[model samples]
Target: MAQFYSAKRRVTTRQIITVNVTDLDPFGQGVARHEGKALFVPGLLPGETGEVTLTEEKRQFARGAVKKRLSDSPERVPPRCPHFGVCGGCQQQHASVSLQQQSKSQALSRLMKRDVDEVIAGPEWGYRRRARLSLAFSPRDQTLQMGFRKASSNELVDVHQCPILAPRLEALLAPLRACLSELETIRNPGHVELVLADNGPLLVLRHLAPLSAADRQKLERFSHSEGVALYLAAQSDTLEQVSGEAPWYTSDQLRLSFSPRDFIQVNDAVNQQMVARALTWLSVEPGERVLDLFCGMGNFTLPLAKRAQSVVGVEGVAALVAKGDYNARLNSLKNVTFFHENLEEDVTRQPWAKAGFDKVLLDPARAGAAGVMHHIVKLLPKRVVYVSCNPTTLARDSDALLAAGYQIRRLAMLDMFPHTGHLESMVLFVRE
Candidate 1:
């Protein structure tokens, strides 16, 4: 027989009830209840009394909005950014800074079904190290606009200044727009990446077609005068550095290296803090063996290698592995090595399968390394640190670890993407 609740269910209106939100949902929505049914209130905080109107009704839950705030949390403060709510970039802007951190912690606990603490917090603002923005140019109006998508639609939200960005990076929006309109035969400019280094900005433009000789020359001229290292996305998923001396670039401290297409954390300030937190949680001894999975350009691998006896970073892409090796050699890191192995796929048959390690660090993408987690649980290290961008998968894998006799020791929420609702969390476990 089929599952009892798997079939289609009717959609009907239910009695709308208003209650004080007391917690956060897995997706960072505020939690309230009416008639004992869970209500997800977006842009709300705990201890806030609000009037909620139900829009949809489901069996286990419903979604609602605050029509009015009857009372506010003592911790509440007005969001600093103007693009608050309209832009999909941040969700907790309506909440106070302290509550944003607490919401993330509570969300982790709710999702993972485990206890987590809030012992650590990263910088509040000016933390974003990298950002990607979508572009839209209207030929009829000869208009150029670049920003993120709106909250519930495919439309782009026009933003002149982002409160969370480094002031230097935010200052480039006007000049960049001026330069784009100078192009002769441009149809569409899909995206622009604002990569911030210690010196200044490295602007990466995603052009839908090849730039004419004149536009290319103009871009080069702008780079020379502006001190902005200009790069052009020659092909889809390809980044070619044009003005910078090196084909590959370095992070602010050069602690990590990245290619144009390779993924990097959005918030640089939070990233450094997160990496440090993982290293602290691991507590690497001088001779401890550690494995870094889904390691991108030795972000954590190199730092972990400094303390550990030997560290091996394995990635799916050979090019990234090569770059990681180069980064390790350039830094004169003697104990770190990198290998190309697809952690997304079943990696049980790899050459490093049997080797034992004292600790393991997982820095997978949004999909959350489920395949690797299965293989990793077998190795059974003394400690495991999971760096996750997605909480649902973290919860799923944490459940697996719990079944295998591991207890969560510490957890933290980093506000990597400030104005947006995106969450970054770190969890540590010790074998029970």
Candidate 2:
């Protein structure tokens, strides 16, 4: 018998296929079924038909780019930013704000298995108070390119003006780019962070190499001319203030002083409203002891202290814990205390956990508080508020509370990031 070799099948990466979008995913991608697999098409809206070219293919699903739309949805609207489709900062700019929120709300509701009781929103544009722009130097052009990363790629898209940024920060982009382009030792710059604090605008430049004296003076001059606080980050952990005072933002009548690298909510107006709403839903009593988990820089802890008998804030980052303490002192909040501990581990053994809390409030990261959900149950707090930035994790963590006989008293969708796919929410769980 002769041995014969057969040619292997070839799979084409790019194939145009007509798709009828039945729904929109949480990330603003259109949902359609193509050849028994879920097809995700960008820039396509629900109730729209489009020709999509498959860009990525996997066993269970596929992602594609919209080649041509056969039909359009009434809810679709024009994106405001010039860099809307290219920039990765926002995903739902093409859709109307109402449509985006509705899609996100439906997705969240399906995951949580409950109807969202309320929706809290703020200004759609000019709401971002903080943003970090990527910096790269093109060797061919001998010019510094400053902008955000392209969607799902490392390539940077040069952004002239960001409509979502605060007015003051947006205005500084051109001049700041000009100033950075003139710097000598900033060829291999890391990134530039622009923050509009309550006091003033702040600029933090991350430089991999040491800056020369002349470059420092130039930066100082630019900072003075723009009246923006400038900080130079020579290392990941250190920041040297080249000009201006420390930055702080006010919330709940308390001043929170934070370093430039600290994690603060990007939206100022929504954050203020979120804090107020969280407080209102928590309903902290004057004589009740409260616990705030994953509390960074006392965003919620200090406010709870004003109403509660005493409030304890537990944070993982030591720097944020220190800032929390500092902010507590700055606000003259004597009833609150800050503790630095890894919340992922068993925090029930900590001194702060020993004293039982009447109520608990947790504002966790996108990962949610899987590690602390069980611990919160053991504490037997009468009421618990969970502030989540990721709905999947929130739903997973909510199981623990529900299993422990806690009922969701209130659930509200927080539109912290208007145009982005980031779905923030808060839920109040009352022990039955």
Candidate 3:
């Protein structure tokens, strides 16, 4: 079969080349040009002259890895993590903090075609409140490797500690590995979710098979000794809270409870700032109706309710919708309600969709809200605030809103994921 043979063609006379990087791409790779062909090298920064081993050749561009650096950029700094170059968790660790922000703002500005109004910065280190530690049994070594995946590869990095995680969570890495090692019954354990909730650290062990009583006793002992919450998710859609109090967090005059499996912002400080800025930009007024799409656990819905006459939160997940309802009642906000509606589908006929919201807030996932943007425009909301985790989708959606007679009023880039090439942005669009 044609597929049996390698699609790649081998090129002879390929040799290492020294190139001077001129710019950095969104993925934090250095951009270099040689013989009129573009080259991309990882761990190489702009204004740096580096030796690269050309790994692949394509029609237009080439890909390589930095072998040695002849000259370094002024913005280049030593990465704090020992596994910086290897771990996929962080990509821009070699760039200075200010440089990292500058690059991100530049990339976002170029995509949006508008000057960024503000840059919301947060703690440079130990700011991650939650993380998913990969688990794999290495038969070759007869040991378990618990850490993040290698950069551009599926192999585990076996990190002893992660500097980006909260201090409380970082302290549990060794202990977690030791605990897993002690559990003989846990063959092929899935993954461990570490959460640094406002209450404390919560450890969620996801397993493919059932745990033995002896294994449960050992986990219970570990949880008690460590004074952290523990949960088991043997089956999807089911979480058994084994021990400890429920974890919760407060933001923008509202408190919300969450489980380890629930989706929450990774950076707490930036989240607070983002929520505050979103409310400020929207400028919700009394007697005004607000609609929050993809409202997860009322993160923005509850806060928006404080200043508006009424707020309706829409989410696809029934569990999150229930959580939002509980949060509204927990905060004693009678004007707020939540509904379960698949945003990807046509929601124009839903009862809540006819509420005639004056303002709209969207915090969609990485796919962005293209599927709902046109329908939302039909509502004729005076102001729309879109929070995006992916810039490419945001750019595409911006075009959609512009076509619908909405003008970009303000834009801010949030460094929610510092030290990584990932970017988060908030855009305010007003009727033209």
lDDT of 2 at 161: 96
Can you write out model 1's per-residue Cα lDDT over 164-211, one digit (the tens) per residue? Answer: 777777878777777876886456576888877655678888888778
Instruction: Name the best candidate (by lDDT).
Output: 2
Q: List the residue pairs that clash in candidate 2.
A: none
Each candidate's clash count: 7, 0, 0
Candidates' TM-scores?
0.88, 0.95, 0.95
**In angstroms, what RMSD does candidate 2 have relative to the true structure?**
3.2
What is candidate 2's local distance difference test score? 0.90
lDDT of each: 0.77, 0.90, 0.89
- What's the CA RMSD for each of the models? 4.1, 3.2, 2.5
Which candidate, 2 or 3, has the higher lDDT?
Answer: 2
How many pairs in model 3 have backbone atoms within 3 A of each other, for residues 3 or more apart or on separate chains, i.e. clashes? Answer: 0
Q: Write the per-residue lDDT of candidate 3 for residues 269-359, one digit (tens) a residue.
A: 9999999999998999998999999998999999999999999999989989999999898899999999999898877678877768899
- lDDT measured at residue 295 in model 1 versus the true structure, 0 to 100: 87
Name the candidate, 1 or 2, with the larger lDDT value: 2
